[model samples]
Target: MNTGVVTGGWSYVWAAYSLTAGALFLYGVSLFVRVRRIVQ
Candidate 1:
């Protein structure tokens, strides 16, 4: 018998953190590339 229990609070927090980190990284890289292109 397997009980399916889907519930958590930390999982939500982890997801938010991952999303924020990904967005920040992408934004930073895009900004850096744009600046480099503008300088060239």
Candidate 2:
């Protein structure tokens, strides 16, 4: 008998989490640079 659709969820979750964290990190760095430039 075939099981319900719950396989391969861990990889997908990890991918999504990593991408989101990376995007947020880059965004924060961009904001910091802009603020520093403005302060100068």
Candidate 3:
């Protein structure tokens, strides 16, 4: 009776997505700051 279905893995998926988004956001902010500094 085993059909090989995964269940209850949403939390891990969300955690990984959140981490990736946060890292990208921080990287964008850092680049913005660097550009501003270079412009000044």
Ranking by lDDT: 3, 2, 1
| Model 2 misplaced regions, further than 4 Å | 1-5
Pairs of residues at least 3 apart in sequence or in different chains that clash in candidate 1: none
User: How do the residues 1-40 of candidate 1 rate in per-residue lDDT, one tens digit apiece?
Assistant: 5498756779899999999999999999999999999999
| Worst 10 contiguous positions by lDDT, candidate 3 | 1-10
lDDT on C-alpha atoms for all candidate structures: 0.94, 0.94, 0.98
- Model 2 weakest 10-residue run by lDDT: 1-10
| TM-score for all models, in order of appearance | 0.67, 0.74, 0.79
The alpha-carbon deviation from the true structure for residue 30 of candidate 3, after best TM-score superposition, in angstroms, is: 0.5
Displacement of the residue 15 alpha carbon in candidate 2, Å: 0.4
For candidate 1, which ten residues in a row score worst on lDDT?
1-10
Candidate 3 local lDDT, 1-40, one digit each (tens): 7799888999999999999999999999999999999999
Q: What would you estimate as the lDDT of candidate 2?
A: 0.94
Candidate 2's TM-score:
0.74
- Ranking by TM-score, best first? 3, 2, 1
